[model samples]
Target chain A: MTTTLTASKEQSCQTLLASGHTACTGCGEALAAKLVLGAAGSNVIVTDATGCLEVFTTRFPQSSWEVPFIHSLFENSAAVASGIEAALKSLGRQNEAKVIAQGGDGGTADIGLQALSGMLERGHDILYVCYDNEAYMNTGVQRSGLTPFDCMTTTSPYGEFSWGNKHNKKDMPGIAAAHNIPYVATASVSFPKDIENKVKKALSITGPKYLQIHSPCPLGWRSNPQLTITVARLAVQTGLYPIFEMENGKITKVRKVSTPKTPVEEYLKIQGRFAHLFKSPDGNEEIRKIQEIADRNIEKYGLA
Target chain B: MRLDLGAIAKAGTSKANQTCGWRNFKPIFHQEKCVGCGLCKIYCPEGCVTMVEKKKYTVDYTYCKGCGICAEECSSSDIEMVVEEK
Candidate 1:
C-alpha cells in the first residue's frame, strides 16, 4: 500500500516544521523536530512545552510549524495533549489527526515527568517526544535530570570544588517502558531515517507512546555546530547512547555497534562540556568512569 | 514585518528574514559528484536544500546559515563548504 505516510526525500524538505526559524545554526533539536514532524505528516496536532524548540520555533511573529500547534506550560504538555486527544475522540475525529507532545530533557525528565506519567497511565493516544540534549539549554544551560555525569553546565560548572554534574543521566526510556506504554524507543538525530521510522511506528500504535531522541546542542555542549550530526553519531557509536526499541515492555530491536567500536573519549573530547575531563589526572579517572558506564550499556544491550 | 503584539505569526514567515548574512561559509554543490543519495538534504537543519528531479540538489541560500551540515554530511563529498566572499 502506497501510503504517502513514509517520508520521501522530496516530501521531507517541505515538512510541517518548515525552514527559516530562529533555531541556532546546525541545531540538532531543530533537525530532529523536522524529521519527527515530517514522519508524523501534516495530519497531526503538536503540543510544545516551554524549551528551546518552543522558544525558537514560535517567536511571536514567526512560527516554523505548519500544523495545528499549541504551546502549554513547561510541565503540562502531556496533559494538554491528552485533552486534545480526548476532544478529538469526543468530536468523533480521533482518527483525523495524531497528537504529539514534545519538549526538551528538562521538560520531559524533570518538570513534566508527573504529567507524562499520568497521561501514560490514563492510556491516551498521544506520542511524547523528548529531545534530550542533556541539559536545560534554553534556560542558559542548567543541569537537568538527564544531564550525564561530569558534564559541565552553567549550573554544573567545573572547578576546584566540583566536577560538573555529579549525577548519571536519568533513564527516561526505561521509566517510560516500565509504565508499559504500547511503544517506546530511543533515537538520535544522526540517524534521520531511524528517527523517522521510529516516530511512524510509534504513531501507528493505539495508545501512549514515548520517544527519547538524543539531540546535540552546539552552544550548550561547546561543540562546533557543523559537527552536530557527527556528534550524535559518535554518541551512539561510542555506546554511551544505545539505540533500541521496546514493545509492550519488551526489547524488540537493537542497533548494534559495528566492528571497531568508537571509544568514549572520542565522543567526549569533541564537546567542550567534557573538555575539563581530559585536563587532569582526576579528570582522566572520571573519563574511566564514563567509559565504564558505556561499557555497562554495551554489555546490557548487547550493542556490540 | 509588522507583527501584532502576542500574536502567533503566520507559518514560515521567517522566510522574510534574511539569514544569509549570518553565514561565514557557503555550501557549493557539485552535480557531477552527487550520487543523488539525498543525505545532504536530509541532514540540513535549515531544510533549504531542494532536490531537483530526485537526482540533482540545489540549496536555497536565502535562509542558509552556512552551518556546513550538508557539506559535512554529504557522503560522496559532492558538497563543498567554501568561505563566503565578503
Candidate 2:
C-alpha cells in the first residue's frame, strides 16, 4: 500500500506536536489529529480538551497547531467549539473558519459527554472527532468508561477472580446518530484518504457532523510503534472495528473488510493486555464474547 | 438524491451535549513449543487470562491491566508484550 502522505499533509504535519510535548512513540491519537487537521486545513478553529492528544500536542509557548486551536478544559471542548461556531456565524465570519472539537476517549465518552451531546443536539455546523485510544492514557492508563470489558488498565488489574474492565464500550456513534446529525462516520488513522474524504464531505455539508476515529496507542496498548497502521488494519479485518457512515440518522454505507473474518485472536494475541488469554482457558469465554460482539457488528453494518 | 435540508435544520434544534474518553489495552502472547500449562493464571493480577475447553487461552482485557508479570514468568518463550492499537 502506498501511504504517500500528500505534500500538504507532510509539510503541515507537526514534526513537533510541541518542542518537548510528551507522547509515546507511535501514538495513534497524535497521528490521527495531525492527519485530520491537515485535511481540515488551516481555515479552521479547533477546540481541544485536556487529554493525551491535547497534552502532547500543545504546551505553553509551543504548539504544533498550524491552525487556530484552543485548549479548553477537559469536558468543555464541545461547548467551547459550539460557542466558537456561533460567534463565527453571528459575526458573518462563518466562511472564514470551520469549527472542530477534538478529544480522546476519556474526554469524549465520559467527562465531556454532556457538552458533546449538547453540541450535536444543537446542530452547530461543526465537526467533532474522537480519536479513541480506548483508555485514560494521559493519566497513567486508568480505565475509562469506553474501555472494553476485561481489558487491563492501571485501575483494572488482571487478577485470579477479577478481569481488568467489566463493561462494553459505549456506542458513541449510535448516540451521535440519535442526534440526527447530517453526517456521522467511523474512521481510522490507517486509511488517511478515507478520513480526509469524509472530512471534506462533512465540510461541504451545512450541519453538525461526528467522526469517531480509531487511534492505536503504542505505549498504552503495548505494541510496536511502526505497526500502528497494521494493527488498525487488523482491527477492521477482524470486524472488531467497523468503518461506516451514517447520514440523517441512518446507516448509509460501510467499508468492506478485504478478507474473511480475521480471527479476533490474531489481533488480540499481539497485545499485552490480552496475554492472559494465552495462559488459561478461562479467557476463552471472554474471547468468544468479544468475537460475538464483532461478528454482530459486522452483521449490523454489513462489513462482511 | 436531494440533500435533506429539513434534516439539517432539525439537527440545529436537537441540541446535543458531548465529551469523550478512551480505555482499551491490547494483549500479546507468544505461542512456541510448550505444553499448554497455564501458570500465568496463578500470577495474573487482573484474572484476564484463561484457557479454552479444547484449545488455547484467551485474555479478558476488560480486566487485564497490561502488566508484564505474565510475560516475566513464562516458563517457555510463549508470551511476549504487545501494545494495543487505539
Candidate 3:
C-alpha cells in the first residue's frame, strides 16, 4: 500500500487518462480506466472493445486518451492487441512499449470471450483488463454473462415471475488462469494501489495476463453517486468479490478481509439493483442465498 | 470553451464544462487537518482536487461532480461534504 502512495503521487503530475469525458458523475469504470492507464503509463498502446469505456471516452471528434489507442469493434480488443504486440515486436519496439486490451464485462465475458481466449491461448504479450460493472451498461443495462444472480437489470428485471438474473457471474479470472498465463488477478477501483501494482506486475510479464476489476456502476446499480467507492470497498470486504493474484494457475497472494468482516447486506443494501432482495419473504430468501454465495467464496478463496 | 474543429480536443475538456451546478453536495477541505498525502487527488474521478502547496490542496469546483470520494479517502478526515445551496 505504501507503494500505492508513491504511485499516486507520481501519477498525479502526469495523468494519462485526462478527465472531461461524458462518463457519469461517479462512474466506476471511468475511475478504473484512469487508474489503469495511469499505471500503464504513456509508453503503452491501448486496444479498446466497444463498450461504455469506448463510447464515453472516445466520442467521435473528442478523445480522452493521451496514448496510441484503437477501438476494435465489440469483441476483438484482445485480438487487436495481439496484432499490435506482434507489430511492435516486428518493429523491434516490443520491449519499449506495452499492449493493453480493455473492455467492459459484457465485452470481456460475453461477446469478447472468444477473442480473449484465443489471445490467452496464443500467449501473446498483452494485458487484458476487464472492467466488470456486472452488465451491459452501455447498451441500456442488459444482463451479461458476468451479471450476478438475483441482481436486477433492464433485461433481468425482478418481478412476480422472476428474480433478476438467474445465473451466477462467470468465473472470468478462473477462465483466464486456465490458460496458464503468468498473472491473473481480481481488483476493485476502491483499492487503487492493488490495481496499479497488478497492472505493473502484469506488464512486467511477457505472456497474456488477465485483470478483472470489480467496478460498480452507479447508474446501473441505482446507488448514490457519492457512495461508489464505499460500495466497491464493501464488495471486497464482504467477500463477495475476492481480490487475489494467481501465478501459473496457483494462488500467490490474497488480500485478506479486515477483522470483524463486513456482511453481504452492507454491500447489497446500497444498490437499488439489489433492492428487491430486501423487500419480502422471497426477497429475504434470495438475500440468504446471496449471502451463502459470499460465504462460499470466502471458504473457497480463503478470503479470511 | 471554443471547439477547434480540426485540432484534436484537449485531453481535459471537462474542465471548461462546469459540472458543479449538478452537485447537491460539495467537498470542503479543512487545511488544519490536511496531511498532503494526495490520496484524494488520486481517487478523485474528475481529477478536480489539485495540490496547491506541499501540504495544501484545493478542489476545482467547476469540474468536480461532488462524488465525495475526496472526503471518503482523505487520510486525515480533512475533506468534508457540505450541502450546496440552490
Candidate 4:
C-alpha cells in the first residue's frame, strides 16, 4: 500500500526529496532529510556527516542535492556547519542564507558528540538534525549510543546468553539543550508537518537548534523497506519517540500519543533487531526490561 | 589591572541571533498535590527545574520556556502552566 502524503502546507515534498537516489527501498532517513530540505527550500547550506544518508544520497561524480551540500568527516558535520555559518556572517550574508548539519546515530550520538556539543555551546547560527535509525547503518549496522538496549546490531548480535545492546539510547536532545541553545525538538518522519514547521521556525531563529528525527532503517533492522514511515509512526504510537520541543532549556510543548498506546511488542516484533527479545526464554526478561524503559518514557513524557 | 569587558560587552544578541516566537511558556507543576517525583527533573530537556525542598520544586523562570512537560508527566495534577512572564 502506497501512501500519498499531502504536500506540506508550506512546501512540496515531491522535488525536494526528488527521485533516483541510491537509498535502499523505504529509507526513512532519506525521507526525513528530504522533507526537511523541502521545507527549508533553497538558500540553505547543508553539511552532512559520513553515514548511510550521505553515502546513499551522494555518489562520487553523481549528486542528488538540489541545494548546496557539503560532505564532511564522520564527526565534523557540526563544526563544518559552524564554519559555513561563520563565513555567511563574516560576509554579512547571514540573513540571506541558512545552515544545517545532518548526521546519523553514530555521527550525532557517538563519534560526533564532541563537535556537536562544541557547535551548540558556541551557539552557532545553524540547525543540526540527527536522523536516528538507532545504529550506525553506514558502518554495517554497528551499535551506537542511540541504539536502544536489547536491540540487535551487527556488533550486538543476539545469542543464547546475550541479549544484544545493554544500554538505552543516549539522550542527545537533553545534551543539546544543556548547551543553552535557543531551540531543540524531537520529531519523527511520521509527523512531516511538525518536522517541517520546526525546520521553518529554526531557519528564522538565530543561535543553534537541534532536532532529533526518528527515521527507520529497514536493511539494518531486518524489516521491509516500505514500512519506513510506518515504523516511525509506530515509534511515536508506542511512546518511544515523543514529539516535543524545548526552548531556552525548558520543555515548551509535547504531543500526546493518540491513546491506548501501542504495545512495545508491536513495535519490536516488526523489526528483526528485537525479534530475539520475545523468542528466547532469556529474551523475555530483556524484553520486560525494554518494556519498562518504554513505560518509563511514557510516564516521563506524559504520553498516556 | 585591565579588565577586558569586550567579551561581556559583545555578548548580547549579536554573538547569537535571538529568534522570535521560538519559545512557548508552559508551566508544569503539581502545585498543591505534588509528590515531587523529580521524574521531570530527570527527563527535563534543559535541566532548568530544581527541587526547592521535599515535594516542592521551583522553575528558574529566567530560563524556563514553558514546555508543559512537568504537568503532563506528573502523576498528580499539581504541575500546571502559569504564564507569568518571559
What residue runs in model 4 are displaced by over 4 Å at the alpha carbon? Answer: A1-5, A8-10, B1-86
Q: Rank candidates by lDDT, best first.
A: 1, 3, 4, 2
The fnat scores of all predictions, in order, read 0.64, 0.00, 0.39, 0.00
- Model 3: residues with Cα > 4 Å off, grouped in runs: A1-8, B1-21, B83-86
- Residue B12, candidate 2: alpha-carbon lDDT: 14
Docking class of 3: acceptable
Worst 10 residues of 3 chain B by lDDT: B6-15
DockQ-derived CAPRI band for the predicted complex in model 4: incorrect
Q: Give the higher-lDDT candidate: 1 or 2.
A: 1
**True lDDT of residue A195, candidate 4:** 77
Question: Which lDDT value does model 4 have at A272?
Answer: 86
C-alpha lDDT of residue B43 in model 3: 81
DockQ of 1: 0.50
**lDDT digits (tens) for residues B15-80 of candidate 3:** 445567778889998888887787877788766677888778898887778888788778888989
How does each model score on lDDT?
0.88, 0.71, 0.85, 0.73
Candidate 4: which pairs clash? A251-B67, A252-B67, B26-B66, B27-B81, B29-B78, B29-B79, B29-B80, B30-B78, B30-B79, B31-B78
* Candidate 1 residue-wise lDDT, A1-304, digit = tens: 0012222556654567777788888899999998898888989999988999999888777788888888969999999999999999999999899999998999999999999999999999999999999999998999999999899999999999888999999999999998888899999998888888899899999999999999999999999999998899888988899999999988899888646877799999999999999888888889989999998989988889
Among all windows of 10 consecutive residues in model 3 chain A, the one with the lowest summed lDDT is: A1-10
TM-score of each: 0.95, 0.74, 0.92, 0.75
Judged by whole-model lDDT over C-alpha atoms, candidate 2 comes out at 0.71
Candidate 1 collision pairs: none
Order candidates by DockQ, high to low: 1, 3, 2, 4
When summed lDDT is taken over every stretch of 10 residues in candidate 1 chain A, the lowest stretch is A1-10
Of candidates 3 and 1, the better by lDDT = 1
lDDT of 3: 0.85
